[model samples]
Target: MTFSIKDDSPLVSVITPSYNCSAYIKETIDTVLDQSYPNWEMIIVDDHSQDDSVQVIQSYEAMDSRIRLIPLANNVGAARARNIAIKEARGDYIAFLDSDDLWLPTKLDEQVEFMKSGNLAFSFTSYSLIDEQGHSLAIEVKAPQTVDYKHLIGNTTIGCLTVMLDRKQIKHIEMPDIQPEDTALWLSLLRNGYQAHGLPKILSKYRIVSNSTSRNKWKAAYRYWKLLRVQEKLNIVEANFYFTKYAYNAYNKSRGLQPVSIQNGGK
Candidate 1:
């Protein structure tokens, strides 16, 4: 069913956690500014950035009332920064977009309708990967139409940038202060019997930064292992089983197996 967003659409609060992302933050903000859905507030929480990121974001905040900036006193990690923005969110829906990523113009418009049509609490859309230069790598990670806890434990198909959550359904939202915090949050929601439905549209671009912790394979693997053992409390055998599946998916996502049309500037 086709749905058109109206002028009186429910407000969406975009949560953005920023660190030293001055280089790509402007582009990220531009994508949100270009969104077809205008009823949204982008709350950018800067984690004590040493660079000019705070100044850059504050400039936009001054121009638009919907764009807000919260500069932290200390350099908290992304997990904490995100939580701060979450606390300040005053919208019916919540969306996450990292400072380095980009979103399609129709992302929020289409995703809001997708959630409403199914009465979904949590939902995510397909997203493509791009280089730090914002050039599409022709690698896209597709999302299944629906995912439950059983299927999600072995697969990290959801991307933070493409996620949209209905605040009305989820009364309390929080993320553990740990590596792979987004994954932990997803698992928690799914474990509570909340099914995450996906709109299979490439609505966002996840930028692969060279210096990002995700680029370090061993570290990333260790983080996932810890999440499984400590947070999920899975036994050794079960941990290894799920870890293998997660690793396999991560490997495929790194390659061009799920290839899409290559575009410049994350178009």
Candidate 2:
């Protein structure tokens, strides 16, 4: 399962939407800078952060040419901020990394190799959960080998930070201005005949803060339902069916029942 990435590897545009994540933005930036894959640019879109997040990002950008900062005058939202970055991205591949999230060094290397080897247009990797203080909770969400629109409807395990899309193959893929916008984008691509292959490696770290949307299960469910019924416009029965499966998966992942090794071929 070893792969090699050359110096002239395909350029990866890493997009990050920042919103008052000063506490953890530095480490996040550091993680990206330390990636084993060198041919990449990180666009950290700041959504009018009220803290020192921008300062931290700027400090890093000052040192590294690969790191760029897009500061918004007014606070829009995560989806909109990401869209702005997407519009300006100049790379063969599009990748997402949130401000508070962390990526392991080999993330880009492994994922890019996986996609290139399999001729995959879209792909994601498994990620572990971290607490607000950056302590591992020993919980990892597993990703399936391959998922289409239908499979995604029943199992929404694709993490935004773990996802990498081949823009050369799939074009005009933007995050919708809605709750769970990332998921919406994934579904839209899959619906349009793009299958996302999962690498199943723990290559990213998702930080769970108290105010995180994932913490509010009921609210998250409601927003997901809205995404299905309103944004994507699935029929009531289809929406309910997908929503039910989503709820079950969410419950299981919350309980740490679906560990990374178990889902990723017991690796």
Best by TM-score: 1
lDDT of 1: 0.88
User: For residues 1-267, could you state the per-residue lDDT of candidate 1 as single tens digits?
Assistant: 123557669899999999999999999999999898888999999999999999999988987888999999998899999999999999899999999999999999899989888889999999999998988899888888888776777776889999999999999888897789999999889988799998998999999999999899999999999998888888888888788877877787788454222121100
Candidate 2 clashing pairs, residues 3+ apart or interchain: none
Angstrom error at residue 92, model 2: 0.9
lDDT by residue (tens digit), candidate 2, 69-122: 999999999999999998989989999999989999999889989989998899
Those runs of model 2 whose alpha carbons end farther than 4 Å from true positions after fitting are 1-7, 259-267
Error of 2 at 177 (Å): 1.4
Clashes of each: 0, 0
